[model samples]
Target: MEVIAIQKSAFDGMKNELKELLEMTEKVTRKYTPIFKAEKWLDNQEVCLMMNITKRTLQTYKDKGLLPYSKLNRKNYYKLTDVQALLEAGQPYNTDGNGFTDQ
Candidate 1:
């Protein structure tokens, strides 16, 4: 193999550029990445308990678009705000004569 040498000044400049690139990347990530309140994010069990509904009913809510959820790692998560909104709406959970709630 042939030995090649790079100028120390050139190497230092390249290193500085790389550092700047890393800092810029971090700034962009912070700017663009979605910020979620950890407490606002509720897992399935927490939502079920809070809503006083079973898991099956929760699935039904999802199927009918009554509740919005995000699935991660094969587990479902819901926003507390959305759940509270549903409770306040007082329409989605009430079933009609057809046994399905009106959307």
Candidate 2:
């Protein structure tokens, strides 16, 4: 019947539209997704962004032992909690070894 044929055509069109929509969504998600390195450690660039500090400043903290970090094959990683503590502290530039100042 013509009605049956029309229904089948509509169903096929809807199926194709759904497939296209899914593909589009996949592309969009891929575009927005962050690509992470395999090191499983945050690099200096990421640390600077998180702590709102210059890379040299982060290096200074690292050198002074004020910021605790882990080393993975020459790469450094600061814990999220450490970064949060640093933000909450609002201390001066010098590392007194006290770790985090009261804001």
Candidate 1 per-residue C-alpha lDDT over 2-24 given as tens digits, one digit per residue, 9 for 90 to 100: 98899999999999999999999
Number of colliding residue pairs in each model: 0, 0
Q: Against the correct fold, how does model 2 do in TM-score?
A: 0.48
Q: What TM-score does structure 1 among the candidates reach?
A: 0.55
Error of 2 at 45 (Å): 1.2
Query: What are the Cα lDDT values of the candidates?
Result: 0.79, 0.70
Candidate 2 segments exceeding 4 Å error? 1-41, 94-103
Distance (Å) between predicted and true CA of 9, model 1? 24
Off by over 4 Å in 1: 1-34, 94-103
Query: For candidate 2, lDDT tens digit of each residue in 1-103?
Result: 3544458789999999999999999997786454323224467788888776676678778887778887766888776667777778863483334543222
| Residue 58 lDDT in candidate 1 | 77
RMSD of each: 7.0, 12.3
